[model samples]
Target: MNQFTDKRKGMDHKDLAVEARGLVKVFGDNRAVDGVDLNVRAGSIYGVLGPNGAGKTTTIRMLATLLKADAGSAKIFGYDVAKDAQIVRQLIGVTGQYASVDESLSATENLVIFSRLLGLSRAESKRKAMELLEEFGLTEAARRPLKHFSGGMRRRLDLAASLIAQPPLIFLDEPTTGLDPRTRNQMWDTIRRLVKEGSTVLLTTQYLQEADELADRIAVIDHGRVVAEGTVNDLKESIGTSSLHLSIQNEQSLSKARLIVERVLNVQSAVTAEGGKITAPMADADRVTDLLITLREAGIQLEELSVQKPTLDEVFLSITGQNTASNTQVKKEELA
Candidate 1:
């Protein structure tokens, strides 16, 4: 076997698909990635979340061996990324924000070419191409040139191309950035399936919902550093386990209601911008009953009330203190 093959053999069956420590990358005076560490468990979905220009892509490039790190080290399936890049490349696949497929080629033709380049037999290439096209719900568009495909269709085809070999680890950088809800959900299902079939998915996204839905564990990156890392529940509980939300029937009672909620719950509460609803973190679920009783006794009639676990949006804001959607969009446009 070749030296690269030998390295691959030795690194096989590792429990961590990706292990990165103190990874730093600098572009001139800009330190795009700084002291970031990540550990992605094999066969699980791990999300890297950040706003635009937050080093998410730069960090992925270093881990994928597309870019060298300025400091620290990383390994893919136990093979060092810098010293064993060729072997590491064989064990991982990457799908970026933009499709990498040939625009002039039909979907079937593109996948067939990728399969052939990966060393499948001619008949096997065609079969794999068709199978993947169908699996991605692109059977009808298989014959259409990619230039005519919609953004969502192109994204799906790009992901399908990456899976032709079913590499053990996949890096997805904002795979659903601009996709419609339906297309985004479809991509989510495919990502889940990749993990179910034994591929480790390390995806970077700006969408809170996407990370919350797909990631078993997440690392929240901000200012080119890992600000927080843990399971979804762990991060949510870091701020508060659950939240109390209520809307009062009387507009004037809103102020009174906020006071009662804070006093009874022993936590600060925020009123919505329109001065209609109040929201507070709930430390003890039992305290919810006390708050409700206090509000009613104080002559505040409730319009709506519910206790819900802190959403990933809340978690991100609490950690980074930024509005993800607004900040990401402004920064993304600036980057472009």
Candidate 2:
């Protein structure tokens, strides 16, 4: 047996809705998805985070059965993705960044059409549509064309359509990419409800905050490989427990203050975008008290002081050296 199989020998594979191993896909000599493995527990949100070109979308497509893996194996609910693609189709729903709701159709019309296509009777489809429209807070706008809906409303409608069958597993590819803060929060609430109702989700996004806020477990991918995998706290602890941050009142003393902090703490300092400020990541909070005394004796003239820790954004910048825009462009199209 392979190492992965051996490691999972005694575990319940059914508890994991997604188990992919050594998944590889290439495009024109570019290895879009390298030897990546994923294990997402059922009924939890598993976030795939990376900058652009990080192979997140490509890997997701493979698991969704929209793209075939060039190598390795993937299973959804113990059904092989390649050998049991038809069954896979029945088990999952996909909602991309762009809402797929028809622009010409009203909210009610869109959901009804999808439900009908999924084989619901006319009356059943209409009933399902109304339920979802109200669940998604589109009841008042049910008769409005998708073109008249705001970005967030359209996305909610898109998600509503994907749920026409209430599949066991769902794939959400950046479901809140360009949404406003309030709308993003609304979408987050919907996703949480899905998990509460017993649906497993595989969400891929470039938004670090969204991942931090939602994912039960997270995997950071870069250059087609996973560089880190763990819960939010686990990843933060890997970087550092917490850090001390302060802002200088006097611009002239910034350089002198920075040097004093580095020499006493023996850790590098990061300058934030806010003028006259510096940050240092440290494990012990007690150290901040000592640093304060030393800086006081030196008369650094500090304006602000606080204790903080590393965030997921720092984790991505620390490891990948890029932002969400660094995602992969080498995707395989079924052009043949």
Candidate 3:
């Protein structure tokens, strides 16, 4: 059995892995994390989704005990972050946005160093290092210096190092941010495996699809506050039951088609920058037949049409009141 698997006895015995209420962090005049509340269930993956500077990282820092909350309280596995920091630290593993591995060390050397520091014997450390490297698909490059590793390779190694002990609760802050599609899929599988092996994951990510795929529940933060929180389906239902997306063959018919859509569906429709795409929320998917007949009568030729559950992208836009535009003017919470 692997070292992590051997140590998994009763790791998921607790019910709540992380609990935070009114978590706040201030940077001078800017309130980085403002009154954020989170309850992460044990042995499940919980996602925190937000655009940049929305305090996702700051809130994570507070929960991980890396930053003291200006106001509010947090606990990991029922141990208070402020009062029982040492104990809390022993129960959680954290992987931040950047890789924390040493640039001069080989992948194997880095993992072995971490395992040894965590009190593993020399032989066990070496064995565990190779095991992790192979799992992360880094065994071929295990002997290469980190300086020579690509960004994705470094990120995978960083996560591998953090899993050497496989603490009960793991805080992954945008762990797959810059990874390519293939590596991201691998990371997703690893995360699922971690939870399956009796670990709870508190993940912070800007990628909505990642949350939709991994999180049992998600909290959407905006302007340092949670604007929405629920399961993916719950959040989608909050906006509408279903979404209608259609495109006309002619650009000239775009405005007329959108008008018919709103008139028939009795809802606001959003126009895309693309040729003739129009999107709208549908409370009753049955109304689409009426919309289609109305459009046909108006001489609109549809190039494509689809009625589907609301996507995470639409949920994010609806909740945040804007697309994921980087606001350089906002007092970024990440500022030192």
Candidate 4:
């Protein structure tokens, strides 16, 4: 056995499918990923979330063996990422942020070509290609050139190509970034199917909803380090308190409503005149009924009132002090 394979055998199978310790990357003077660590459980979907330039792509590339880190170590199924890169490559598949499939080839041709490149026999390649096409609901248009396919179709093909070798680990970088809602959901279903089939996925995305929906665990990275890591509910609970949004009938009513909410709930409240709205965090859910009663008794008419949990977007903002979408756009521009 090769030295890489030998080292991998030393680790227990139940250990992480992918693990990184004190991972750091530097470009000139910029530290892309600084002191970051990750532990992705076998067959679980782990999401790396950040705005653009937050080092999410850099981390993914390093794990995929496309980039070497300046410090720290990463392992794929017990194989060192830097020292045993070849073995790591064999054990994982990567789908980059942008579609990498050749536009001139038909969808089936693209998958078949990749399967063959991975050392499948001609017949095996054809069979695998057809299977992937059917699995992704692309069999109807398998013979059409990729250039004619919609953004969603092309993305599905890209994912199919990555799985030609059926690698145990998959790296998906911003897999659904520009896709429409329907297409995006379809991709989510495909990812779930992969996990069900015992594939471990490491996904990076700018979409908070996507991460919440697909990831078994989430790590929020900023400025090249993980700022928060946990399940979606765990992260939300850490932020503390649920927000109550009230749309009062008029600006005057909004002002009164905010005061009442603050006084009765003993919490901070803010009122916006333009929207005639009052928003505040409620420490106790039991206070909701009292809040309504208090508002009505005070002659404050509310057009709408609702209590909502903090969304991932809100969590990102609270942790990083910036919006995830805006940061992602800035990073894209920089990369372009």
Q: Per-model C-alpha lDDT, please?
A: 0.82, 0.80, 0.82, 0.81
lDDT of 4: 0.81
TM-score of each: 0.77, 0.79, 0.81, 0.78
Model 3 / residue 198 / CA error / Å:
0.3
Better of 2 and 3 by lDDT: 3
Candidate 4 residue 321 C-alpha distance from true site, Å: 6.4
Candidate 3 ranges with C-alpha deviation above 4 Å: 1-14, 240-278, 282-285, 292-313, 320-336
What lDDT tens digits, residue by residue, belong to model 3 across residues 1-336?
011111223534357788787888988887878898787889889999887888998898888889999999998889999999989888888888878898998999999999999999999999999999988899999999999998889988988888888799998999999889998998999999999999999999987789889999888887788778778766656557678899889989888888999899887777766555788888787888999898888899999988767654566556654544343244444934
Off by over 4 Å in 2: 1-10, 241-280, 289-309, 317-336
For TM-score, candidate 1 versus 4, the one ahead is 4
State the displacement of the C-alpha of residue 78, model 2, in Å, after optimal TM-score superposition. 1.3
Which residue pairs clash in candidate 4?
52-328
Clashing pairs in 2: 51-327, 52-324, 52-326, 52-327, 52-328, 53-327, 53-328, 54-328
Those runs of model 4 whose alpha carbons end farther than 4 Å from true positions after fitting are 1-14, 240-242, 245-283, 288-309, 320-336
Q: Write the per-residue lDDT of candidate 4 for residues 5-63, one digit (tens) a residue.
A: 11233556466898888899887777778988888889999999877788998998889
Candidate 4 lDDT at 115 equals 91
Window of ten residues with lowest summed lDDT in model 4: 1-10
